[model samples]
Target: MALPLVLFDVNGTLSDMGRMTQHVEEIGAPPQLAGLWFATVLRDGFALTAAGENPAFRAVAEGALRVVLAGQVLNRDVDDAVAHILTAMQQLPVHPDVADGIRGLTAAGFELAALTNGAATTASGLLERAGVRDAFAAVLSVEDGPGWKPAAGAYTHALAALGRGADDVVLVAAHPWDIDGASRAGLRTAWLNRDASPYPSAMVPPDHEVAQLGDLLSALRT
Candidate 1:
C-alpha cells in the first residue's frame, strides 16, 4: 500500500525556536522576552484570523517585535533590533531529530510536505539549510491558505493544493491545536510531544503520539 502524505508543521515542531532567545539577547532585549514576544505574535495572528482576516506572518511578527522591544534598552534602533531578530528567525536550523526522521519517513515511501503559518520561503529556507528541502513535495504557508492552523479551512486548502484527500494526508505537529484542527478537517494527526506535556483536554486527541520525531517512523509504519 502507498504510504500517506505527511504534512509537518515547520516552526516549533521541526525547527527549534530556542534560537530566538539568542537573537533576542543579541539585539539587547532580555532573553526571557523571546517567549513572550512569540506568544504575542501568535495572539495577534489568531486575532486577525478570528476577525475573518489573514495577515502576513512577517508583518505581524515584526509589529509584535517592535511593541515587545519598545521599552527595552536596545543597543540599536528599535526597528533595527526587530529586523535583526526577524532575520534570525528566517535562518533558524531544524531540530536535532528532523534530519533522521525525515529521511526515515522518505525511505519508508511516505511523501512529505511542510505547512507553516509563516511564509513558505522561510520554510523552504529552513529545510534547505538543514539539507532536507528536496524531501518535501511542497512547502506551504498560511498566507496562501484561508487562514492559519486551528482553522479547518487552512488544512483543507493544503489538501487541495497537494492534490490529496483529507484522509490520505496526516498532519504531524507538536501543538494540540494543530492536531485538533487537522482532525476536525478529516485528516489523521500525530502529535510530536517532545516535552511530555499533557494533551489539551479541550481539543481532539491525536491518532498517534510520540516523544520525538524519530519515533514517528515506527508510529506511521504500524
Candidate 2:
C-alpha cells in the first residue's frame, strides 16, 4: 500500500527556533524572552481563534514582541528590535535532521507538505535554504485556512487542499496541542519528541512518537 501523505508542522517541528535567543539578546533583551515571545504569540492567536477571529501570524507575533520587550532596556530602537527578530524568523534554519529525513521520506514514496500557523513564505524559505523546498508538494499557512491550528478548520483546510481524507494524511509536529488537534480532526499524528519530553496526559496521544524527523521513515514503516 502507498504510504499516507506526510503533513509537517514548520515552526519548532522543522525550524530551529533556539537560534532566536541569540537574536533576542542582540537587542539587549533577556535570552529567555525569545521563548516567552513565541508562547505569547500562540496564546494570543489561540485566543483570537476561539473568539471567532482568524488572526494574522505576523501581526500577533509583532504585537507580542512589542509587549514582551516593553519593560526591557534595549540598546537599539524598539521598532528596530522588532524588525530584527521578525527578519530572523524568516531566515531560521531547519533542524539538523530535516533535510535528510525529508529526502528519505520522499525517496520512500511518501509525499510531503508543510502546514504552519505562520506565513507560508517563511516555511518555504526555511526549506528552500535547507535545500529541500522541492520535496514539499505544498507549503500552507492558517491564512489559507479558516483559523489557527487546534481549530479543526485548519486541518480541514489542509485536507481539502490535498484532496484527501483525514485517513490518508499524517500530521507530524513537536507540539502536543498540534498533534491533539490533528487527531481530533481525524488525521493520524506523530509527535516529534526531539527533547525526550513526556507526552502530556491531557491531550490525545499521537499515533507515533519519534526522537527525530528521520526516525519517521522507520516508525511509519512498522
Candidate 3:
C-alpha cells in the first residue's frame, strides 16, 4: 500500500496548551480557568460551525476569554487580560514527543501536514519553533474552508490541498470530535490520548489510538 499522508490537528494535539495555565495565572485569574477558557473557545467554534458560520479561531478565543474573565479578579484590565492570553496562544510550545515523532515519520517516508481551526501562521509558528516546520508538506486552517473542523468541509479542504483522497490520509488529533469527524469523512483516524483518558463511547471511534505522538508510526505499522 502507498504511504498515507499524516494530517495532524494543531491546538492541543500538537501544541502544549497546558503551558498556558501559567499565563492565565499571570493575569490574576485562577489557573483552572486556562482549561475552561480553551474549552469555551472550542465550544463557540463548534457551535458557530454547526450554525453554518465559519468563525475565526482567534476571534472566538478572544470572545471566550472575555466571557471567562468577566467578574473574575484580575491583575490587568479585561482588554489587557485578553491580549495577554491571545499572545500566549501564539507562543505555545509543542509536546515533547512532537519533534522526534515527526522526524521519525518523515524518515520513514511519510508525508505530513497540519490542519488547524486556528491560523496557518500559528500552526506554522508552532512547528517552526519545534524545529520541524519544513517537515510539513502543508499547514492549513479551516479559515480557508467552509467551516471549522468536525464539519466535513474543513477536512475536504485539507484533502484537496494535498491532492489526495480521504483514504489516502490519516487524521491525528487529541480531540474526540475531530477523530469522529475525520472518520465520518472517510479518512483514517488516530486519537492521540496524551493524558490516557478513556475514549468517549458516544463518538465514532478512531482506527488507531496511542498514548503519545511517537507511538503513532508504530501503531500504523502494526
TM-score of each: 0.96, 0.98, 0.99
**Which consecutive 10 residues in model 3 have the weakest lDDT in total?**
76-85
Alpha-carbon shift of residue 60 in model 3 (angstroms) = 0.4
lDDT-best of 1 and 3: 3
Q: How accurate is candidate 3 locally (lDDT)?
A: 0.94
Write model 2 residue lDDT over 71-164, tens digit each, in one string.
7999999999999999999998999999999999999999999999999988888999999999999999989889999899999999999888
Candidate 3, TM-score vs. the true structure? Answer: 0.99
> How many pairs of residues collide in each model?
0, 0, 0
Candidate 3: tens digits of C-alpha lDDT, residues 116-200: 9999999999999999999999999999999999999999988998999999999999999999999999999999999989888
Which of candidates 1 and 3 reaches a greater TM-score? Answer: 3
Off by over 4 Å in 1: none
Tally clashes: model 2.
Answer: 0
